[model samples]
Target: MMTDSADEKPTETVAERGMWGNFRRWLGRGEDDLQDRLFALDDAIAHHPSTAINYVLRGECYLQIGYNQLAERDFEQALELGRSALARSAWGFGAQVAQDRAVRGLRIARRR
Candidate 1:
């Protein structure tokens, strides 16, 4: 999640609620700008395919912008990566979060 205050300074400090806020701001912005952010996230995912945070963020963005197919793909990828991370660690919180995001994503995707 992220935020932009009255001064319009972007801040990446928000709980789950901020996800919607971020989505709204992105949606209201220009399409090219939003796509750039998406591409940046995509690049990050490509470099760190197993990162749960990156996957969740990208998937969430896609879902927000009505790209359910892409969202599903990101979510599924996140789930696989999360499971792998979970297996490789004794206590992996990020992996657990990613797994949960994937399940939620499936529910969101059901409408598509």
Candidate 2:
């Protein structure tokens, strides 16, 4: 059995690799960190086509940076993925949250 320690690096390195760096960039608070994270996320999704968290995060990033169309697509994708996830887990909340977000994104698009 493996035991976690304070100094131990997390196994999910991709998630820890400066995701906020991209968010900061979107806010004009940092350098162009999105391209690299987006590329990595794209590759990860290609490898694991059923992953939904990536879609939600990408959608949020797109919205934050004013890419409404792209954000809508991502939010839609996230909703679908959230649905699938919900189907697989009886106690899942991600589906509801994703659905709410998608609805909000659609509203934003309508206002534009």
Candidate 3:
């Protein structure tokens, strides 16, 4: 028989924790490596379309690489997928007015 304890914590596998490690490493890599990592993240996103966090992560990478348009797109998609406050803040919009402006910007971009 097995017993469960309230103080026991669930364990995360290396694969589950690798994203952050990879992200940290990517931050210090050159442009080419960053691009390669971004491509890999895109592939991961393709396989996991419903994961909002993946979109946000990819958006961060895009922003770092000076791809503002793509980053905005990903942030907008993340917001649509219910990312809400985090996504808005990540795009540098923490206040309600800023969030509204972001929404308008997204709408304008979509219309073009």
Best by the lDDT measure: 1
Give model 1's clash tally. Answer: 0
Model 3 score (lDDT) = 0.60
Error of 2 at 73 (Å): 0.9
TM-score (C-alpha) between model 1 and the true structure: 0.65
**Model 2: which residue pairs collide?**
none
Please provide, for model 3 over 1-112, each residue's C-alpha lDDT reduced to its tens digit, 9 standing for 90 to 100. Answer: 2225667666433256466664564455576677766866676677667555556667667666667788788768766654454454655433344345446545544544
Evaluate all candidate structures by whole-model CA lDDT and list the values in order.
0.72, 0.65, 0.60
Better of 1 and 2 by lDDT: 1
State every prediction's TM-score relative to the real structure.
0.65, 0.59, 0.48
Ranking by TM-score: 1, 2, 3
Q: Write the per-residue lDDT of candidate 2 for residues 1-112, one digit (tens) a residue.
A: 2227778854434344455643343334233766655665675566556767667666666766788888778777877887888899888776677667777775775466
Tens-place lDDT digits, model 1, residues 34-92: 67668656756665666776777778778778999988888888888888899999999
User: What residue runs in model 1 are displaced by over 4 Å at the alpha carbon?
Assistant: 1-33
| Segments in model 3 whose C-alpha atoms lie over 4 Å from true places | 1-32, 83-112
Clashing pairs in 1: none
